[model samples]
Target: MAKKPLSAWPWENLGSFKYAMYGPLAANVMYSWIYEDSYKHPWCVHILIICALRGFMHQLWNSYNNMLFLGNCRIKQQGVEFKQIDNEWDWDNFILLQGLLATMACLMFPSMDDEFPIWNTKGFITLMLLHVMVSEPLYYWMHRFFHGRYLFTHYHSLHHSSSVPHPFTAGHATFLEHLILSMVIGIPIMGSILMGSGSTSMIYGYVLGFDFMRCMGHSNVEVIHGAIFNKLPFLRYLIYTPTYHSLHHSDMGTNFCLFMPLFDAMWNTLNRNSWQLHNKITSNSGENGRVPDFVFLAHIVDVMSAMHIPFVNRSFASIPFSTRMFLLPFWPVTLMILLMMWAWSKTFLHTFYNLQGRLYQTWVVPRFGFQYFLPFAADGINKKIEEAILKADRMGVKVISLAALNKNEALNGGGTMFVNKHPQLKVRVCHGNTLTAAVIVNEILKDVKEVFLTGSTSKLGRAIALYLCRRRIRVLMLTSSTERFQKIQKEAPADTQNYLVHVTKYQAAQNCKTWIAGKWITPWEQSWAPSGTHFHQFVVPPILASRRDCTYGDLAAMRLPEDVEGLGSCEYKLERGVVHACHAGGAVHQLEGWPHHEIGPIDVDRIDLVWEAALKHGFRPVFQP
Candidate 1:
């Protein structure tokens, strides 16, 4: 490890608490406003607001660039993992430190301390000219100097650690680097102020514009089309694109201009292929390019959970899903977007990651979880699923698994509808319920000889019942239909057939300690379970643990292999690095090179086979307490 720079900031060790550095300054400003003579100036307050605005701008860029629907224009197709996320977690520290430094500079410099009008044309022009003549060259040289041997190893290399740059990557630098950056950035603003041309709007515009360009350069996605530069050829030398900055990271020897290619061109440091690469990325080079090995078809759980998507709020998505009080205020806006999606949006890729050199992606249907339960919305939901499956087939995706309600039996016979409709389709359609049943059954303790099962007539329930009966553990299958019970019972071996006992009332399981809940059970129904019962559930919005004495297992999930890469987001409520069983099942199918479609009924015989395969691939079950 390289030694820490002597210029490191004092609050470097504060972690998230570094924001407290702004507290004393803010309190002083508030005191002046409330009781002191400086109350009328409010320049201090403006500095605070600018700090917040800069942080918000970075977040907006980070979120927007990560949207997978905009994948075609992306300069780097690789995803940022937890390591990069952690490195950039403190990206806003620079903003806070710079705000403090700016406040100090205002107190020290007489010219910058005075207030000016809100808008000044002269100041805006001065800012722009000073930036072009002075700031750009200064930054260009400082950037190049940092890339040299000594500074590169000690400081600038920290910035270069992120191979795939993100918007926050703009601010993720060592203290010494940001200190120099703050000085370089302040030059144009200070020049405008020193010349008596500075105004409120000019400071705001100049600072915000600096942040905007910096973010644009590191966004990883190419938002600027090459056609604009084609029409105005000189503009290429004037403004740098995301691709230009990306080349600097990849090659580390060229494209060193801060926000303009003019300096790079003059210095002969510009990469010859910069414009060509930019055009290639923005134009979507290959018409039929880059197919994933597997696709997990998913849907939104609700308006709040919708915000939990990777592209929306990365920090929130990285952890398990939960309702956040801060997100409640944005619910109305999210609902509006959801409504718009329901009306027109189709299945779109949500995220992708590499596992064992194979690509796996998650594609989401526009419908929310509630829509799947609506009788009127079934046709619309199925239409979206079919469209996704067909698209996957055309892309040569080897396997596509239906997640959550997407594979509900009543809706599509566990994804069998698509296979039968398009019999010649090459992509394998998997409901992944077989492995889901396996995870749930394997969760039962070895010594337990009897289990009470609810939703026994459903696909998973039938498989679970038969699997348990084969193990010689008696299964109290709860169902109203004797014909359905008889059908599942006949599938079991004749010797174990008696173990699959059918019961109509929840009271029949009063003595059973193991309750497998496949359907939602009422509190009254749950009241009959024995005191020590454990509820292993497959039902969505898992049944409330109404029984205080009973323990509840989360929906079946498996931790991804240790070798999985770019898995920065969580799967619904599962823990980090863990995924829902169905998602893992699909991944296992792809990894095993399984040629058969894993749709329709859960084959009782293949339960252990799939479970063993999951274990072999380093996917461990998340056992319940």
Candidate 2:
């Protein structure tokens, strides 16, 4: 008898037909052995179970891999860090997609009725075998097509970005890849339904079985040994192992099997190293050199670039109002072009060596956000900060602190917007406004009973205004609007607003002993008001005040004494022996980053992970990291 010639067409291949028939029938894996109408369970219960299952499996799989260091690769490749990938956000999209799929299934074939008992019996077996057989051929061919040069480069490469594939990596394909992959089950099942041969149990089994098998293939665990295949020789051709898929990842030329290697064998493209590599991996070579270098796919490269668009100052004043208005239709296109140009200008991260007190290394992603001192710039800053959050999330920074414009709510909406945007950031964000405000207020209060506050509507301005107002000190509040003044006035303690003198006039600050100017304060005082008066300016491009008495400071990033904790101050020297807050909330924000408990000492670098650090040293987190 002559062996059949290899063909990409599913009908021409026995393996393809087998995969289609068997993979879906095996979907009984989606149902429980003790079956009942799934409607009996509450929707919340189903959601809870699904969440628990995914969470447990994720942690269990990752923890096991961490211990055994299974299939470890790309830890240090292209600046990728293993710790960075250890994120809660990674599961968010997967869970969402799965939930949607599940809901659709439940809707299409409501699980409310115990209408299908075959899911537990011979019916389950029949469907499992039938779908697997049919899916095999279709899946095999589709899988092969994804490996085509064009598709692989444009779409499938996203999956391969992670040199070391983890369990969740099973669903890490591009939307195009996922769309193509979903057809495997959808087509066959729909075909069966149209022919009046379809059953819910069969569909359930097919989806679950597909999920389980895909997860196993990407697990990187050598559960099926070559020795097992040595004893049970037939299983060798039928069951594809992790080693088979890993080799496919390493070099996409061979071992293309969705379920089995029968067609691969028939095509003469079977990877010979499948079993031997598994042995090496399980034994020493694979385990020893677990980490592999990683490369970025084009899409991610685009996103990383977008995350840090270089700040470029361009004057639009040359264009007439009518000319600019005429270009409004093209403004969006122009803006996007300009943004792309900005993105291409630089990389997302900046590495720096500390030349100050400590000899440690630091990395930063500049906000490049526009108008840090402007209220409306919060939108621009928020967008950039989101990118920074994701970038840091990818790089696995445990803690991040927003600097200058990024830290101000009047500028970036504070850390609240950032945290709200990335729920699973895991890494903490600190505007450090509490500490900055506290320090600046503490220092300024020592010298004056009455202080003039500018930009009172601003976040740090509000914090300072409230603290001073509550302390019963006279605060000459000046803002652009009555609404902003009223807003800050309402936030102050009872009777504190009584001590606040509403002053919309700049000259109202003339009699004040100290002036604390916020970022929103335009046409700020450039000269010393009174001979005896001193000024503390928080916003920068500092007041442009030429007076020797004016001191500019930022308490957000400061160093304190070795023995003191949050009690110490972070003062920037405006003059010799004079340290003050740079922005309205600088000192307060710096304090906000400190640990609540002061058992021993505290130190701060780029970001103060003081809460976690203090916890490790027998101190409970007052302000949790």
Model 2 agreement with the true structure over 1-625: per-residue lDDT tens digits:
3322221222223532432432322333344324744534233234345544554555445434332212343111121122223321242344444444544554566543234334345445555565567767777777778788977766667677765555567766665555456566556555554454556556555655566666667664555655687778788788787777878888788887776888688778798887777666555634343121111101111222222211110011111111324335655654575467456532232211111122111223333334344566556546656676566557544345555555555443565666665677654555545545544565564546788887666666776777776677888878768887886677666767787778877787776667777753443454426655555656654555455664543322233223221111111122111122222122222234442211111112211333233223332211111
Tens-digit lDDT string for candidate 1 (1-625): 6467544657878876888877876886888877987754466788889999998899889878777765557777778888888777778878987898888887787555466889989888998898889889999999999988988988898899987889989988888999888988899998888898888988888889999999999988787888888889999999999999999999889999989999999999999999988877777745423679999999988899999886788888888898989899999999998889778777777888889998899999988888888999999889999999999999899999999899999999999899999999899999888889989988999999999999999999999999999999999999999999999999999999999999999999999999999999999999999898999999997888787888889998888889998777888888888889999999999889899999889988899999999999998989943
Candidate 2: lDDT of 19? 29
- Lowest-lDDT window of 10 residues in candidate 2? 292-301
Model 2: lDDT to the true structure = 0.49
**Number of clashes found in candidate 1:** 0
Residue 536, candidate 2: alpha-carbon lDDT: 64
Error of 1 at 445 (Å): 1.9
- After superposing all C-alphas onto the true structure, candidate 1 shows an RMSD in angstroms of 2.4
Cα TM-score per model: 0.94, 0.38
Which parts of model 1 are misplaced by more than 4 Å?
Answer: 1-3, 6-9, 24-39, 109-114, 285-289, 522-524, 546-549
